[model samples]
Target: DGPLARLRDRNQLDRADKARNFALAQAGEKYRECFFRAGLDPLRTLDPSQEVKSAFSPNGLWRCESQIENLQKFRAAREAIPEDFREPLAAIVLEDREIVDVGREIGAYKDAKMAGAVALFILRRGLTALARHYRLISPTGAV
Candidate 1:
């Protein structure tokens, strides 16, 4: 990898440049700032453009359900968790987990800014953890 390597790096960076553009009407500056303050970089990659929002979101409350359930299995009784704490995990979650496979996943999508940025950010950062968490509840790519 010589100067040619720099060219390769450029090719890779180009996609992320495109990905940032994909974040949409809603995933605006506030979401970006929130994520950034929380430690996830908004411009990590291109958007996935999945265009799918679930009633049970992946961020906070969804996590709470599984976390609470796991606790029950670990102990005879599971303590009731606060709904507030369970919310989307949001930027707070980023501080706990860093990017895992940034080069491939985060560097690869094309979608809404907030969702895509968060997806790439989460995939790059919390993917392994998310995968591990997913494994406990469902299959690997369920989320």
Candidate 2:
């Protein structure tokens, strides 16, 4: 599960907080899909048993066409958002980093509480923008 799933499972985010808010969850899924399909995810070296075999060899001569297309889409999506919001969005959505760590990296919070709050706010806004870019929801707030 990604950060959004973890948040939802922990009851931090409810499906019905507002009708529009549900789009955030859908957006998160799309963001993760793009990241995965682009082949940007890090190799899992921590646990050899958990590793899945890839069709492409380590020499990188074989390239998947879908992965190339997804990489273009991912780059376009990333370019659609504000520069400042990108890091936090990537950290949480793509890298699965904690909000607190993102907050610390952002570097202006007086306390961890404030840092987490700000990071969460940035993540939500970033995902909302992504949702519109993906057309998972309309620009006028219709899901």
Candidate 3:
């Protein structure tokens, strides 16, 4: 019983180490900053036990048509952005095209810097559109 208990402890320690390393590797500075600002622990969030859902879930959004619909909307919105707003955005798409391309490939490394950059672009554009919808920003994208 003692030997078995020791083995279990070692296995748990190994798993915890692996999870920590994986979390650290995946959680870039942007993600860490966001987590810190939100008062959340990035490490705990990466734990498998704390993971809310599995990729194989039958009801997961990625497995549904709604996901495709949402992606289409995202694409349309991206395409609809005015030239002025696109000027600032061009730097990211142009400089980090490879990174963004890889990030978009399969949603792999969700917290990667490249993925975060792409997400940031979407979020900034979404906010711009939302502000426009409310008339908070001009059509030229000025606040």
Q: Relative to the unseen true structure, what is the C-alpha lDDT of residue 18 in candidate 3, on a scale of 0 to 100?
A: 45
lDDT of 1 by residue, 1-143 (tens): 32212322444212443332222101222232333433223343311122213432454332344434433332211011122322222322323322222223333533344444444333222322332332321334222
Best by lDDT: 2
The predictions' CA RMSDs to the true structure, in order, are 17.3, 6.1, 18.4
- Tens-place lDDT digits, model 2, residues 1-143: 76777765654533455545666777777777977876666553221123324544465432578866776787788877678998788888777888878887886986889888888888877877888898867887567
Candidate 1 lDDT score relative to the true structure: 0.29
lDDT of 3 by residue, 14-64 (tens): 244544322222222222233233322324342222322454354532355
Q: Quantify how close model 2 is to the true structure by its C-alpha RMSD in Å.
A: 6.1
Q: What is each predicted model's overall lDDT from 0 to 1?
A: 0.29, 0.72, 0.38
**Model 1: runs farther than 4 Å from truth?**
1-69, 73-111, 130-143
Question: Considering lDDT, which of the candidate structures 1 and 3 is the better prediction for this target?
Answer: 3
Q: Which candidate, 1 or 3, has the higher TM-score?
A: 3
Runs of candidate 2 with Cα error greater than 4 angstroms are 10-18, 43-62
Candidate 3 to truth, TM:
0.27
Ranking by lDDT: 2, 3, 1
Give lDDT: candidate 1, residue 57: 47
The per-prediction tally of clashing pairs is 20, 0, 0
